[model samples]
Target: MGLILTEDQLILRDMAKSFFDEKSPVERMRALRDSRDAVGFSRDLWKEMGELGWIGILFPESVGGADMGYGELGVVLGECGRVLAPEPFMSTVLLGGNAILLGGNEPLQKELLPDVCSGNRILSLAFQERGRFAPYAIETKAKRDGDHYTITGRKSFVLDGHVADQIVVAARTAGSSGEREGLSLFVVEADAPGLTIHRDDLVDGRNGAHLVLENVAVDGARVLGTVDAGADVLDAVFNRATVGLCAEMVGSFEEAFERTLEYLKTREQFGVKIGTFQALRHRIANLFAEMEFTRSIVRDAQTAIDEGRNDIAEATSAAKARCSEVAPLIAGEAVQMHGGIGMTDEEEIGLFFKRLKAAELSLGDAIFHRNRFAHLRGY
Candidate 1:
């Protein structure tokens, strides 16, 4: 899908593509996995990305950002996905950073955003519990103390919990599980006395952690937004994060499709290239169509976020659902078309497949987003 990019957008996209291709290629992920890197990504690369101003693309200039929109950020994410760049970009910038930017008070923003923008701090959002995608299904409890809050709960599948300097946690201050009204977000230091982080390496060669908070104390000033109004903040953050994930999925599936096409052109069967077969050609054509459709949906979602449109929720859900649905399909078909080698650890296609699978199940799967979309549309 050829997006009508402005000069700056084109320049940004090209720059990102060049940087990731040179600095953090798919080969880098393979290296990380082979060496069993505990950190899962390079701090040097992250700082370099910060120096390039990629981390600040979506924020305002007042907070040390470039004052760019989600569209520009999406462009960078797409390039990262293309090479399966193993960085905390999505977890830190999209999830944790957005949570703070949207939900934190002005003072909190001034204190945190600069560090985040400079890559001096790593942050993660700890909201998921019971392995569920529903943001309101929070079981963590944050009891209000005299001048602080004591949080007690376990958060599963926190994106960067293992290495985060700070974590944004959603806990029920008043409401029951699955109820939206009583949820609250708090910034908890990863080294808090009663907090425990159980790191787990995901199948995609990325690191995640299960966070256990046992009476973890947080200052009152660490609360993000109102005490019992975090549902709105979570909703906004998830929607933007979903769009960013969709953008990455688009890049991933497109690359998978391209790699499959190249394989077909060269891998011969019965004395002729597989690309010469009508059946394979038809399948490739279908996959190409799906990729383009997913790209358009992602572009629309990014634009909706940038414009602050009334239908941002609906658009984001649609984009996420469509991307989730098609990404796995493309990845699976790419593997199948490549025969046995595609499944091997040495094959790059397998890595892309794993990454796509992770993205498919990340914020929400297709079924989850489809239901959310229907509910948002008054269905």
Candidate 2:
């Protein structure tokens, strides 16, 4: 089935596809694998994206964004995923940038968002700990002091952490008995005195970091939302992130599927092309059906969120869960059908496989999303 994209969204996807095709080729990504820090895209390309105003596709036009909804953002994210652009779109654009729009103070938005929109500033989320999948399981503390808050604890798996100019952090200020109560999110400067950043490369070849806050102090102006009332806003940020991630994963799977199909059309076994084999063709058709179903799931989820529907949790969980399962399955079959050649890094198909595996666990993964789906269904 065809996608339900408007001409504007199609234009956004086309723009992103052109940028990714030019700037983030697989060879470019492989070159950055050995680098100690980030696997980001070209600076000039990033500036071009900024000039296009795509960095703020979902933000209000008043705030330097294009004011497009997730429909367009999802399409763009899909294009980003196709090439595995390492420019921290989800971390900066979808998560850190979104928090400002959802709950940041007017001054904070004015001070930070303009630079972010221009791609001059890199930002990311410092929201999880050892247990990233649990949103309310934070042990990080940000206690109010005289004119600031002192944070003490660790946040792990921060996307684009070491390279970020700013980090949006989530910390707990109250007891677990009242989980959501007394929790808060804050915007911490990357170079804040008491902060230490340790970078780790994720399975996807992206630079992720674990931030250690040894009594890192933040001024009163750094608080993101009302003190002890950040849970809802954080939920919104993740919801947006989830929807965007679904798009990315879908793109990855889409490319992998197409690549595999092309391979089947070319590879000969027993003097015949594999695509002519009835058994393999049936399998490929089955994968396509499942993938198209997932496409519908992601589309409906994006539409629900874009329309401010109350069933966002349910829709997002369904989309993420479907993606988590289907992407890996499709990628694995793509590799299997390609045989030994798919295992080599020299082959572009292998790169897509690696990226697909990485996307499998991003944000929440299949199991987590499945459980969330159950919870939303009142199980």
The clash count for each model shown is 0, 0
Q: Which stretches of candidate 1 lie over 4 Å from their true place?
A: 1-3
Q: Which ten residues in a row have the lowest lDDT in candidate 2?
A: 34-43
Give me the candidate number with maximum lDDT: 1
TM-score of each: 0.98, 0.95
Clashing pairs in 1: none
What TM-score does model 2 achieve against the real structure? 0.95
- TM-score for candidate 1: 0.98
The ten-residue window of minimal lDDT in model 1 covers 1-10
List the RMSD of every prediction in angstroms: 1.4, 2.0
| Residue ranges of candidate 2 with Cα displaced over 4 Å | 1-3, 34-39
Please report, in order, the local distance difference test score of every candidate based on alpha carbons: 0.90, 0.84
